[model samples]
Target: MKAAVANTFDSILKIEDIAKPKIEPHQILVKIHACGVCHTDLHACHGDWPVKPTLPLIPGHEGVGEVVEVGSAVTHIKNGDRVGIPWLYSACGHCEYCLSGRESLCLSQENAGYSVNGGYAEYCAAHADYVVKVPEGLNYVDAAPLFCAGVTTYKALKVSEAKPGDWVAIFGIGGLGHLAVQYAIAMGLRVVAVDTGNAKRELAMSLGAEYYLDFKTDDIVADIISKTSGVHASVCTAVSKVGFRQSYDVVRRGGKCVLVGLPPEDMPLPIFNTVLNGVSVVGSIVGTRKDLEECLEFVARGKVKAIIEEKKLEDINEIFADMEKGEITGRIVVSI
Candidate 1:
């Protein structure tokens, strides 16, 4: 099998022929059709986070493929089934968080593209219990981003507790934020889309955002406060310190702020104001398997669409460069 291998931190991936992976008794071998290149992949390649991936790794978590082989212990899935391998590789099912359906917070968890070999190759093995079945009508390329970007934002909104007709602000308007706007509208919330460009503003408006504010020019905090008397909830998918502050700023008293973007440094928050306002700040990672399923079902039902550009696996290195430079819009799916 051919793969784009990350040999070291801050280095371009080298395409090479590698041996196919073997499945464990609880795993399944998938012949990959598509994989989404996430910013998390670039962060992994650069060793931006405290923990780093093992060298010579295959870094891709949003993988969609057809099951070619299943281990003897797997019974819920079979050959020829289309499935997705998300960031949450597997979790200890008996843990406290897992038992309560908050499995994404499970302490004993494995992450694909981070701790183990992932889906940048032609073949990869995934735990059968963690692989989500892709819906019949959703495009494989589109379904790729839903595994990570889609599910992450979806879970954040779900945890935000914003009610119908309530004001919800979505920061970033890019890959995940674009999907976030659609899902917010489908969930009956009025959306305030935040970004810094005309293209993103137009995209957000087309996707049903009730208001669009350019963070670069307009007074983002003031405009949001004036529009809906402060948003009932805010979801941040852009990793900007200033944006994080603004997201916290535009929330009404007793509102919620869900953090999804990963910034390298800690955010300097106003402790006194937060306490006085009774606002809650929460960190949401990727979603559980059930959350991934619900996120994809929104796509399958034609309520949301992942804006994606497809490229061949050979262009993985260039795609990473574009991602680092913040030049690409929406999500890019690499065909394996």
Candidate 2:
């Protein structure tokens, strides 16, 4: 099989021929069709995150493909089933978090691209238990981003506790933020998109955002408070220290602020104001299987859709460069 392998930190991925992976008794062999290039994949290549991935690792978790073969012990899924593989590849079923159906928080969790071989190849192996069945009408390329970006934003909204007609501000209009805007609108909440420049503002409004605030030129805190009478909740999809702090000022007293982006290790929040206003600052990781299923259903029901850019597998390195510079909008899907 041919795969784009990450050989070293701060280096481009190398395409190489490697031995086809053998599946375990509980795993399935998927013929890779498409994989989404994510910010985390770029971070892994640059060694931004704490985990030092193994050399020559295949770094992609937002994968969609058809099942070519299933292990002998696998029963729920079979050959020819289309599935989407996400970051959470496996979790210890006996852990307390998993026992409570919060497998995303399992202490013993194995990430797909970070801890093991992932997509970005002709074929890949995945644990059957964590694989999500893609809807029949969606193409593999379109469904790729839903594995991570869509599910992440969807889960963040679910935990926000905002209801219809409430104001929900999404900070950042990039890949994840764009999806967050659509999801918020579908859930009947009025969305306020915060990002710099006219381009992002236009994009956000086109996606059903009621208001778009140019963070660079406008007083965002005042605009949000005035527009919606104070935001009910805010989802921070862009990882900026300043943006995180701004969320607290716009939200109503006792409102929720959720963090979905991976900020710097030493980033600090305004502890004094957080406690004084009775506001809750929550951190959300990727979704569980149940969350992923609900996300897919949202897509299937036309409640949400992913904005994507499609590229060939050979352009993986170029895609990363653009993503790092914030040159790409929406999610980038690599066709295998």
Best candidate per TM-score, number? Answer: 1
lDDT of 2 by residue, 1-336 (tens): 989999898999998999999999999999999999999998877887666878778999998899999999999999999998899999999988999988999988988888888998989999999999999898898899999999999999989999998899999989999999988998899999999988898999999998999888999998888888889999998788888878767889889999888778445767888888889989889899999998888898888888888999999989988887879988999998
Which residue ranges in model 2 land beyond 4 Å of their true spot?
265-267
Q: Record all residue pairs in model 1 with backbone atoms less than 3 Å apart, i.e. clashing.
A: none
Question: How good is model 2 by TM-score?
Answer: 0.97
Whose lDDT is greatest here? Answer: 1
Clashes of 2: 0
In candidate 2, position 131 carries an lDDT of 96
| Candidate 1: tens digits of C-alpha lDDT, residues 1-336 | 999898999989999999999888999999999999999999898888888888978999999999999999999999999999999999999999999999888988888888888889999899999999999988788899999999999999999999999999999998889989999998999999999878988899999998999998999999999989999999999889999999999999999999999877789888999999999999999898988999999999999998889999999989998988989999999998
lDDT, residue 79, model 2 = 96
Q: Candidate 1: lDDT of 150?
A: 93
TM-score of each: 0.98, 0.97
The TM-score measured for candidate 1 stands at 0.98
